[model samples]
Structure formats: C-alpha cells, structure tokens
Target: MNSQQPSLAQGLLAGQRGALARAITWAENADRRFPQLLEDVYAAVGRSHRLGVTGPPGAGKSTLVNQLARHLRELERTVGILAVDPSSPFTGGALLGDRIRMEERTLDPGVFIRSMASRGSRGGLARATVDAFDVMDAFGFDQLIVETVGVGQAEYDVVGAADTVLVVLCPGAGDGVQAMKSGLLEVADVLCINKADLPGADRMVADLEEAVHIRTAGKGLWMPPVVSVSAGTDQGLDGLLEAIQSHRAWLEAEGRLQLSRQEQRLDQVQRVLREGFDHAIWEGRGLEGYARAMIKASRTPHGAAERILEQLKAALPSEWAQVQEETQP
Candidate 1:
C-alpha cells in the first residue's frame, strides 16, 4: 500500500507483467496488502488450465517443461510457468536450475516463468506456489504449468492444486516399480516416459501401460495413458498434447471438472484456516511462551499442547465442537 507504488490490483486487471510479478512476490512474503489484491482480481481467475508436472530427481522435468512452453507459445497460448526448486538451506532461495534452463522462454512476452524456492516444504511445492498460480491465472494466462521439485511417491503436493497431474518418468530408473509402491500411478492423469531414445524406454512404457490397464480394468476408471517422448529430440510432443487433451475432455464430461475443482477449493480453504488459527493461537496469543514455560515445569510437549487445546475449547465452546466434528475422520 505504498503511495508511490501503483495499485497492484488495478495493474493486474490491466495485464501488466510488472504488477503480476509484484503481486506474486507479495504472496510469497505474506504481505499485508495481498488480501485486497486477491479480492480485487479473484473474479478473473479460473480460466487457465493448471497442469502439474512432477517426478523424481533427474527425470528431465525442466527440459520437458521448457519444450512444452515453447510449443504452447507457437499455438498462441499465453503460458505461466512456476518452477519450484529445492531451497538452498543456507539462504532459503531457489537453486534457479529450471530458470537457467528456460532462458529462451524468458524473452517471450507470452511466457512468464518464475522460479520458487520449496522452503523445506515436503509436498514438492513451495507454500505460496498456489497463491502465485491464482495471480497468474487472474493475469489471463491460458495455461499454468507448475513444475515441482523432483519428488518421491509420497510428496505428491501438486495433486490438489492442478487440474491435470502429469507424472514424468525416464528410463533406467526403476521408476516403474517405485511408481507402483509410491502410488504415483494413483494421482497421475497422464504418464510420460521421457528420454524415450534411451535404453529400456519401450519396456518401461509397456510396463506402465500394463500397470495402468490392471489398475483401471473392471473399475470403470479413467485409464491414464502412457506416452513416450524424447523431449530432448522433441519427439512425440504432439502425442503428449493429445493425451492431455483427452484427459481434459474426460474431466469435462458430466460436470466432473466442476466437482473436482469444488473439492480442491474446499481443501485449500481448510488448509488456510487451519494454518491461520494455529498461528494466531500460538504466536499471536502468547501461547508459545506459555507452552515453553509448561515444558520447563515438567509438562510433556503433548500435555502442554492438550492444555492449550482445552483452553481454546473453553473460550469458544460451540465453534470448537464444530471444528472438531468437521475434522473427525
């Protein structure tokens, strides 16, 4: 809300890239002015297709995403790329590997690429990644590609934020077995066998196809297609696009897209509320110091936490009961 700075909400509505950048920074920093900007620009969201790309390290995700963004620009689609990289522990900043590799796209006006630090988040994404996505969507990008830090089976953070989850795997990694054990196959809307020119590529593709066939068979579920692509050589990119489009069509059928988005929105709301309330109780209300004092007096950490919860319940009886009931499994 600096007087010298232009109104970010107004600038975002006007499609100014500088405003978009600043707004995303505000999201990253939890700036006080962000809520107003979000309120002003929220109606412009929901038009872009969010595609989440994730895989284990060394899977060539950045290369594939660079190629995809270039192709999208050729098709006249404005693209926003969020590359969430592992944070440097010393500085809590992005490694910038993905941004360095995507130098060509930086010059293109249609492609806005931002590199984000994961900041020790386990789910493959930075905490503010989804907030940045919303601002980019409001800026009128036709597509938003969120590339996660190379992730394992359990770090499937992109699932809730993306409309399509694209799982990328390369040959010679034993990723096929890992995918099954990690349940990567469960969250994937499309699977890409990247580095298709390498050895074992075809075998990996076949194995994944068989896996998909088995898991989806007799359940009437949407079978995630296995696509083989050498993004390095730019081979079979069109087929990848087709596979994604087919999934999009399936999701669009019978209001499935609407329902899925609604559920994800609800999840986002719950996460935000939980985080805010926890912070308010511990930090804002001086409970953090009290917890420490209780620990010093021989109370276990769990016991201190239970005492704090009891205090909160006493203060807001009906509200606390509703929260507990809603959170019950």
Candidate 2:
C-alpha cells in the first residue's frame, strides 16, 4: 500500500464524497494504489443493490436512469450513479456530458453521480466500471445504478456486474427489431420500452413480450418482464421500478444473488489475469523481441504463439505444471 492509500480508503469509508470521487478516478485510470485501497475497504462492499441500464442510442436510457435515481432517493435510499458515455476519439474523454440531465440529483448529498468514458472498451461499459462501482459500494450507497453508453450488442458486461439489468428501448428507432435481433433479450432482466406515448410503443411492447416468451418458454428460471414507460413524462416509472424490485426479490428468494456476485468476481479475476499477463509478457519481459526473432526465422504467428505459451507453461511452479498436465486431455 502507498502512503496515501490508507487515508483515502478511510475517507471513503467515512462517506467523504471527495475521497469516493478520487478512488473512482484511481479505478478509472487503473492506478497502482487502487488495489490496496480496494483491499482496505473490501469489507464495506456488497451492501448496495446494483442496477444496470443499457440500450441503443437515444433510447432515453439516461432520462430513465435519472428518474430511477430520483425514485430511489424518494425511498430514502442513498444512490450512486455511474453514467458511462462514449469516448472521444481524440482525447479519450466522455463525448457526451450525461450529467446535464442529472443536475437535479447533483445537489442532493445523498446522491452521487459520476460520468465515465467507455474509452473504446469492447463492452458498452468502461473497463473500470465495476471497479468504480465497487468503490462506490464501499462508500455505503444503498443503491448503485450504472447507465451504460447506449451501444447495442456489446453491452453484456453490464449484465454480468449488475444485480438487475434493464434493457431500455423506445419507439421509432428500430429499437424493437434491433433488440430482438441483437440478442439483447438474452441479457435483460427487465425490458423497458421507453417513450410509450409514441405511435408504435404498444406494438414494440408486444413484439418484445413475444420474443421474451419464445426465448424463455419452459427453460429459463426468470422470464423478463416487459414494461412501457415515457421517461420524458415520468409515466410508468413506478412499473419499471417495481419490475426491478421484483427481479431483485426473485434473485434473493432463489438464493442466486450471492451466486451471481461470486460469478461476477470470478469474471473480474479473469480480466485482471489477462491484463496482467499481457503487461508482464509483452511490456515488462520484452517478449516483442522474441516475436520479431520468430518472424525472422520464418515461423508462423501461431507457431510463435505456441512457443511463447510453452515457455510460459515451463516457467510455472511445479504444482501449477502438475495441475495443467492433469487437466490436459
């Protein structure tokens, strides 16, 4: 741990907003001190119920998220919102300022909102979004809502992190067809048809419900409930909230909440391992030279990769080598 990490972690645990912000920034930048800070505050995590909102662009996701935060606040719950925006190509910063709509909640001390840039991460979420959520969780928010950059198919990461995932769609945007064709239904715990006042909203709802029914049929444990809402007018917001609450209740009743989180943590570990291996082998170990040498020797890329993997395997501890050998066919 660094000299300042302990104090930062303490401040975060004490509910100091500045410290929470700093910790989230550290997570965003993947700072060296973050792991230590996370360790220090690890006990405080897992108290918050995480909800992820995701969909295609202009689906009123931000509006719905803002309204959800307000609704949660009305229930006397402390809310932490992570609104992820697409990255700017040049500066790698958030392209859209999502905080603009969330201005009402900004002044409330009980509500904390942070905007994160996707930074071209493969998922609609920023790579560090779960880390940021963890720090916020440790900060003692009762509810944590992550509003993903409304990118279509690549938004599955949010589902893996959140306790409930609301896939928001709206009329006149090809949203219904896109949601069905892009496999968004597979990831949704609740399907929200926003802008319900529009012409095709009911038809969109019917299409989604049929799709959800067809997909679930007799196999899945939970069939996602489709709800319609006009976030702009705040209509049917209660129904959306109720659906989320119902899903959470179902997860808890079925003893799957903890199981889901355990799986998510394992996924996080895999991502960290991949990143650590990439940095250690390519950057720290100067294995780029090995690749160049193999190229010069007329070795195929796959052959070079196999040789590197063999070297890596050989360098493992004896116990790991035995385990690997035992696992191999």
Candidate 3:
C-alpha cells in the first residue's frame, strides 16, 4: 500500500492478490486512478473469456450463470461474476438479492461474485462495469460472466462484451416468446428456453427455432441454438454447457472470435466516452430545477432537454460532435 503507482502495477502484473483487490475497489469508486489501473492491467487483458447472460426477468439467468460458474470451476478455472441489479430510483440503493440464489457457492474459493447497482447508469449497467471486468481479468480470473438488467433492448449491451451471449427465456410468462421477438431474439448467440418441465416448453422451443431461421436466414453463421433447460431441477445444464462450448468452438473455427473481440474493443471505447460525457452533464446539479420549470410552463422535458444539451454540447470535446450529429434528427 505504501508503494506508488508503478510499484503497484508491478505487483499486479506479478499476480499479487492484494493489489488486484485494491485495483477493483479503486475502479468501483470511480477513483482518479482508474485509467492507470487499466494501463497496469493491460498485459493481463485478453486472458479471460467474457460471457454475458441476458433475457427477460424470471428466465433463470442467475441460475444459469451459477451453474456455468460451477462447471468452469470444476475444470480448475477461476470465475468472476458481475451481476447488475436495479437501483431504487428513490433511494439509489440496490436490492442486490442475487446472493440468496447463489448461497451454495458463497463458500467456494474459486468463485468471486460482485453485485453492481445499475446506479441510474442506463444501457443495462453502470459505466464502470467494463473497468470492473478489467479488474477481474487482471486478478487472473479465467472466465468472467456479466449478467445485465433483464428486459429492454438496451440490455443487449452485454452482447457487445461477450464472446457468446446466451439469452435465457422460459415458458409460462404470458408473452414470453413475444418479448423475445422484440429485441432479445436478435442479439442472442444462444437461446435458452428455461424451465423445460413447464407447460409449453416444446411450443417455446419451436417458436424460437423459427424466429432464428427467419432472422439469420442465409448468414451461414452457426445458427444460434435453441436450448431447453429446467434450472430448478438441475436438468439440461450439461447440454447447455456443451452448447456454449460448441459456440466457442464455432467462433474460433470460423475466425469470428477475433472479430468479436475487435467489436468489443470498439464498443468499450464508445461506451466509456458516452458515459463520461453524460456524467459531466449530471455532475453539478440535479435535473429537478429544470424539470420543475418545464412542468410549470407546460413544455415537454424533450424541449428543455434539447436546450440543455445544446449548452452542454459547446463544451464537449470535438470527437463527441460526430456522435451528437449522428444522433440528431
């Protein structure tokens, strides 16, 4: 702890566990040392396989991740999980109840589970998540799982980071397949119809197959497989894991893995810039004053937002001007 940044970087590169913990803490706090932490951990990058699990709520995403983590540990692989939970809009505190579902693994030395509050940071996660992944990667975890806020198109951000994104969907929800069709169906590298014991499992699987056939049509990519599993019963997990391994094999065999990595790198850069710019806008004051004025004058938040954004735009870095222009109507 007494050492300076260079020494700390050396310690981390040497695989000192203490330095890894300190680095993760610093990144989570959004400390000024973050960029340096990433720099130090750069050599450790590309060592971990990033897997993202997503889907509608109640699709057993957490359970699937837990199962996968245990499977990886059995292979002597260390695992890190970033579980994104919704924050209370009123209090900014997270429910973070995922711990209950993962009680069996709490004592496992090979697994590290971290719950992150979405923190009003939209797009399915806090901006610091990629940094958090870097911390875990540098800490020598062999695999990392990022589980995003369920539902909504924005949650597909996970796909951008993952080598393979498994979209979990289950039967019994009134509109489960419909919900999948909306956005979940498109980005998924693997589709799981969980709770296979439930009624309509066959129907859901058939629906998903048809959806994939239509979407991918002739792309010649390994068709995203539709898997059925009953997580509660611990059924079909091995097959699910096999499917994941198969997808990874296909990625490597077809040379898409490197492409995925390249896309992920570009995505991280864009996301970091976007979040930094948004944080700057929200820093000095709450938006309450502007909201109140808009309500009083009967103007939409959209109009006021445009004016405020124009003001914020002038001070933005030139690179962001391109982003602003592309987003403009």
Clashes of 3: 0
As for candidate 1, its clashing pairs are none
lDDT of each: 0.86, 0.88, 0.79
Q: Which stretches of candidate 1 lie over 4 Å from their true place?
A: 2-6, 293-299, 317-329
- Candidate rank order under TM-score: 2, 1, 3
Residue-level lDDT tens digits of model 1 in 102-148: 89998899999988888867789987888899999999999999999
Highest-lDDT candidate: 2
lDDT of 3: 0.79
What ranges in model 3 sit over 4 Å off? 1-4, 7-11, 14-18, 175-180, 277-329
How do all models score by TM-score?
Answer: 0.92, 0.94, 0.81
Question: What would the TM-score be for candidate 2 when compared with the true structure?
Answer: 0.94
Q: Score candidate 1 by TM-score against the native.
A: 0.92
Candidate 3: 10-residue stretch with minimal lDDT: 172-181
Best-fitting candidate, scored by TM-score: 2
Instruction: Give RMSD to native, each candidate.
Output: 2.5, 2.1, 4.6
